[model samples]
Target chain A: MTSQTMRRRFAATTNDLLDTDPRVALTLADIGVGSFNGRNHPDRIINVGIREQLLIGATAGLALAGLRPIAHTYAPFLIERPFEQIKLDLSHQDLGAVLVSIGGSFDAAAEGRTHQAPGDVALMATLPDWTIHVPGHPDEVEAMLRRAATSDDRVYMRLAADTNTSPHPATGELAKIRTGTARGATAVAVGPMLDRVLAATEHLDINVLYAATVRPFDAATLREIAQAPEVILVEPYLEGTSAAEVSHALEDRPHRLLSIGVPNTEHRRYGTRRHHAAAHGLDVGGLRTRIEEFLR
Target chain B: MALTTAPPAVHEYEELGRLMSLMTGDEKHSAAATSTLDVIWALYDQVLRIDPTRLDDPARDRFLLSKGHGPMAYYAVLAAKGFIDLDTLTSFATYESPLGHHPDSNLVPGVEIASGSLGHGLPIAVGLAIGLRARGNPARVYVLLGDGELDEGSNHEAIAVAGRRHLDNLTAIVLDNQSASRGWPGGIQGRFSVEGWAARRVNGRNHEALTQALTTPHDGRPLAVVASTEAGQ
Candidate 1:
């Protein structure tokens, strides 16, 4: 029942891991380690000072030297700016690291487009081997961070300001939160979009599924739970990022999908996060209207 | 199977060049690869405290080839050092060959990173230095980068951060072939000097100069050795 920001929980877990595990190294790009309890080792917790490229390159280097490096910063600087470094230094090198990013989509709406990164998940997906986790709540963030840090696989944990009221501890795959009438259209909510999605489909008789770990795309679970030919995917990132995977999962059956989330166009306006959410038709009322129209 | 030691005479540049020539392919980057011949030989034969037998040793020094496009010299040096079999040199850039246009660390025994993209090695070296230092390991990290690669802002960021952190365990060897669109003002050493790094410009082809430049004590600062050479050797 305890609701907190995913970023706060990420820092807390990372600090704990750094204390217990000497193999763990945390690299920051001028983003100060917030609320981290342990700061004993200066060399391990590196701050590259606004150098996003170095942030990733250093993490790769650390990983190369037999260390589990966790690199974090704002989403754009973390994933978008130094994408090549991630591609070459980590992926191409066959090195592994946990890349945790904050500011999902328009979390920094007041700060404008500079701090936003809706395409991060899609960009990371382009890489052949990356486990992308879009955690909806703090508990999920903590669990996923611990899992990623301990594993040698390439992991990208996306932490954002948005949160669901409660944390579902299920991880590594999709969790069926609510099952509706058989043969009704299925609505899937990814990460932070669960709250708005659950509210939007309150009166509908559709099946609903919640997922935090979107990449490795839980296609099997989705296929098992998808009762009808019609599906609606509501994600917290760029619209239709997971549509292909969903369509591929249900390829044997004819299916129609209504993908809802942040649109492709850049909304240059600066305002609150809610304002941007509403403008993108991601709010409860807007999602309800769109879903109802699609189901009609 | 008894490990056959590489012949003592194999350290000669001619032998290294001969090994390089074994791999016949168009666009082999022969010139670029040959340009770093002396420096690579100096590092492998004289300076680096690593051997093919100790490839997995944690305490052994790390050598990252940043300018990886033309890697004949690297392959030759590794072959000469016995890190890789001499027989594999002929299969360079082939589908079944581990020796590609750029070195892949996963496949190559002594390679520290998979590199071909410009401006990535130095920054990664900085991280390696930090990782080693944190682990209390005394191993030094050396990165070989091309002069053209310095144009990348990522190198500058690494240069600045390494200098600021005083990572003396890290060394960057810039193979200056005068290839950049506009060469650094006041020479390549000046760029490192501005970032509070210990830097020296040496003749790329001179083994003695390279040895001295590479081994020069930097005390608390990271060292940058600018090995100047002709555009194509």
Candidate 2:
């Protein structure tokens, strides 16, 4: 629980949700890898080869017809190209379909920049009715999907890198993670890159708050946890999309919010998200070092 | 299917225009913009059998506007057929108005789907035709598509799918204004000339051509009647 090791928990939960809930359907926008097995389900799982717009629209159609549709695709195509569809067909209607997004921030490390979903968190959460949850580890992913499965609420899950650093808390809900004590100041991790933050800033009175729900924020809960005058926001995207904008928006009330993610300079760079994170010190040690200096 | 929407008795196009003028400008424009009103008048007058009072009856033939923006003409047809109050046309596109720029299936009376996007309508039309064929229900699915909307590929896919399936009960009318929005290439009939689509380009404004093509049963393949029209007509 103390270290990172939780990717499987999230996948298992999603598979279980699809298995048990008869009304739940998922459109696999041609993605077979990264957390989802794409097997086990029958014709119900629609594999639309690389058509993000149709994929999203199909999900909306299925949802309108009394199905709980979960559309999971690469983050960039999911929110960027088909943005008009998202804003109109899905988000505007508030169809209550769960948008299970994978590859937040630098998660698309090997695929390079076009694949890195640096602006998604910023773009999506700003919409009228969205609930964003960025879990720090795998256990949180499981718990988040569980909660999402039960509600008719339209949710956008910013997924973590499926292979690395899993966080499983004994008391497993997102609310529990946010309410947990900070080992130092609360370092808010927004993407699947939470383990990097934990590994980096261990010396500071470090307690990790894994807030994953993007919209329909538990504002009271956020305000309560982010009470510290010094708060740092971490996500895998750039300035507009990651936690920085969120930090600034919350600036009106209180809290000293510092935003961190892929810097503007590194946007066009080559490498995987993990490499970029490590290069820019998004990893645990890099984050740990920054906190020590910032607090000092 | 109970046919209730009887065409108003022998009203001249001039009289029909006068009946339409009773509504406000936006409503009239909305009605005017779809296809030439004559096509709609012919459908209600000579062909389709349905009670205007029972607009939502599933047994009735389904008329879908794949050219969703063409509601300009469609609204007047509904009014002329008495499917909706002629006065309700005045509230077109206002807040909460059922007559929006694009049809909202939920709000608009007799609308089958929410559409304004170019490629969306045909699929729903295909669904309707398929459903009726499957259920052994005799309802015909009529879809009006604009030529410019072929800029969207999905409409093409729908045409291909329908033809392959031999859905004799389904009819698709392509409004070949050849214009995308206010400007752009305005000759869809010109574009289709390249494929050498064994097509019939008629004066979209001409009532007889529109009606005969619309009402006549196809021996094989779905019908694509490309009618040329001026913008803002």
Candidate 3:
């Protein structure tokens, strides 16, 4: 299957939805949807012209005025730059909006450090009552955006250039990809990390699980599937974003965990996504080497 | 629409102080609330077409208190206009009361947006104007800001966008108490004028001046009124 960018699917799905639903509105910070501007409902599709803070604030206001607003922009500009607006305007005011962001982790590695947002999920996790979705494929992006647009809850859908080989249709909970014997190690992969994770553990005896939605982390399912004392968590964004939840899920039993993802240190090196992935030990070979070392 | 309860029998504006006195318990922002007392009163009493009966009406005017740090004046005005019961005034800031230091849209009867942190209200107001316009509703959107709050860059973003979009249904009231660390060189009204908004300056404490300035017609652009008053009055 040919890989597709999640940003393209997001624009298509949102544009289609805007045609039928008058309640649905789109706010942009001059990031996505350059071509769809002419066909889109001029009033519904608001381009705030590079103002990230107003992007969120206006979305909150649209929600306040009884409209469902989907605010889109790059990850760093959407989450980090206008964080206070997200906290006070939307969350504090009890307003609902669908915040869809692109350029996850190091997808914008070529654009330099300013464009990358490895901490988007971790930062959004700080706010209460947010539904965070890290979709791994274009199909998943379409499904998640449709779901979030129909609901009144505050949602943050993180999309990226990195994608799994095929879409995993299962959502809301963890999907068990391979079940191993009890008392062995279990590997949990989040979003786009599934492809590399599957390759890394292809010949191993450990169980593997894939998750598209990370927030409201499925501890119940983890508790049921994680029979072994050793668990490996591989995320696409910041390392150990869900470590506390994993520990809490297994509080009754003493277990060990190995978290693999982008490290905390800034690489500061300009390169491709693959170069950054390899540098952070997130590639298939690096992941396999680390997982094998941990199992031994 | 008329007020839910009978209009207060006695001096209406004078009763604001009495309502404000009901919630006193070592509040730090009593002075801050006093600074916005007259403007809030004038807006609720004369200019705004909102009441408890029309709280959910799409065409009803929206009044957002952007300068939300001191909201005693806001609570008093809501009580005076009968959007909220006068009985709820004494419960302000209590653990169980809906009336907190900063206004919450969900908890309060007629608040359009929750605001306390500076510079959020104006942008939200701009968005509301756009949303209302898209819905083809003629309701006007109004937001009140503190002079010091302009130090936040978010307000500038809203000011520029609203002016550029020609949001004629929106009005921003800046209660300039001369409180910013570095005050605007040409005065706050000039800041709005430079951004293509219809700008005006008035004595914040004078009801007639506030009404006249706020009601001034700005046909094809957003309006900004810098109501000057003493800080901590």
Candidate 4:
């Protein structure tokens, strides 16, 4: 792991937030055994146990009753199974709760496809006004945990499975890595997928952009990134022919925008996230190649 | 007009008589579905200042069936009160009836929240109450939830928040039917599991017991009435 990866880890941020505020609660759904929860305070840690519906429903209830809750669980099951409860209880009621949907995408190869939730990012992104946080590296994860605990609105932080070291943001600007320039064409990468974006920019005259917050994609930031000749959108969820929508949003500009994400198919082959990343042209080398070809 | 109670319901008895005759037999536990019988009749017959001809009036008091599946009795009361044209109790659980086995506020005109899933109505009711109170209107809100659904975490949070807010305009009625579902075990039950609800068991058929609870002035705090009943009441 790189020194940059060590910069962000959720454990410390979560511990500090739970300790500082008595109103704040950390609810741990029965996830990977021996999760580093409950160290803050047992009473502060609510183990709802294998019940995703109960976890979300109870958290909404608790929030309604004047308590702030951070409900943590695996992504695939909670995002899909109890979607109705989440939609009605949390979203419809507008009673905010922070959801930590962990083990996204290839992080599930060790378990199986059932545990992978690549689609959640796109589904969650559609909920109007909700904060969609996909931390690129561990440092961003730490910065985001602080934001999640303090922010009063609904925030869905789609955390990646990679525990590898990455640089945490020292300032609020890098804390999220909202909007930045690379070198050649503008490449906007989300989650830890920035590693691939950075790698792909080699031997090229392209610029790169990393988005920490997905929902209210800082329009100003995107406009700045669009200052470049071309732009690419990266997400873990499948992009179903909406590649044109990305281009259309920037139709006024003289740029060819391409979306890099999972395809609209049931993925016949089951393998590592890296494998899917490679086939879908999401790797650093693949992205660099795509840029070189497009720019040429 | 000020809300008042009806006395000597021999007229009510005759209506129930016709309802039972039309219901015919015990296929889906029709006779046993009397948990909200007296509560519905009480609201429809006396307390509610509403006209059957003007069911959707803006000034009318809102009655939400939190225990929506209690329609075995709700339809009977609605028919008796003329919310619908006929006492078409036979069409229950049939094709495209305004009445589903459970009430969807979206479908049924008089219904407020679609609640077959239980423990859902009160929060919405609280929302309605808060909005109405903010508007400085006298329209009161009533939500009737099953005692069994108090086990749901939603109920506890709703009650605590409403109570803390002193929402006097909202009256929450708990139908202590004892069982969450058929053959799911039954017992002496309460609502919201709060101190006031646990103080006593209610007699569902006893009009006076409900009257004492429902009519009590909430004095700025939300009111809860644990109205209990037996299967065949």
Q: For candidate 2, what is the DockQ-based docking class?
A: incorrect
User: What is the C-alpha lDDT profile of model 4 across A142-239, one tens digit per residue?
Assistant: 77777677767888877776532355452322122334444456666665766676666655655555666666655555555567767777666665
Q: Please, what are the lDDT tens digits per residue for candidate 3 over residues B1-233? A: 22212244223888888889898763788878999999988787668876576678888888999999889989888877777888898898899898989888889998888888889999999999999998888889999999999999999999999998899999999998888999899889888989899999899999888888888789999999999898656
Docking class of 1: high
On TM-score, the stronger of 1 and 4 is: 1
Tens digits of per-residue lDDT for model 1 on A116-221?
Answer: 9989998999998899988888999888888888889999999878899878875677888888878778998999999898999989988889889888899988
The digit string of per-residue lDDT tens for model 2 on A14-55 reads 677777876666666667545564566643465555666666
Candidate 4's C-alpha runs over 4 A off are A1-8, A36-40, A163-184, A240-251, A268-271, B1-233
Q: In candidate 3, which residue ranges exceed 4 Å CA deviation?
A: A1-3, B1-11
Q: How well does candidate 1 score on lDDT at residue A20?
A: 92
Off by over 4 Å in 2: A1-22, A33-43, A93-96, A135-153, A162-184, A240-253, B1-16, B19-66, B78-84, B93-100, B105-107, B112-143, B153-172, B180-233
Better of 3 and 4 by lDDT: 3
Assess each prediction's global lDDT (C-alpha) against the native. Answer: 0.87, 0.62, 0.88, 0.63
How would you order the candidates by TM-score, starting with the best? Answer: 1, 3, 2, 4
Please state the error at residue B66 of candidate 3 in Å.
Answer: 0.4
Ranking according to lDDT, highest score first: 3, 1, 4, 2
Candidate 3 lDDT (Cα, 0 to 1): 0.88
lDDT of 3 by residue, A1-296 (tens): 12267888888888888987899999998877584553559888888888999999999888877889999989999999999999999998888999999887899899989999999999999999999999889999988989888989999999988888888884779888888889768898999999999999998888888889888889988998899899999998999998887899999997999999899988798789999999999999999999999999
- Give the distance in Å from residue A291's predicted Cα in candidate 4 to where it truly belongs: 3.4
Model 1, span B1-233: residue lDDT tens: 11122334344567886888888783548788888788888887667877677678898889899988789989898888778889999998899999998899999998888888889999999999999998989899999998998999999999999999999999999999988888788989999989999999899998888888888789999999999998755
Worst 10 residues of 2 chain A by lDDT: A170-179
- Top-lDDT candidate index: 3
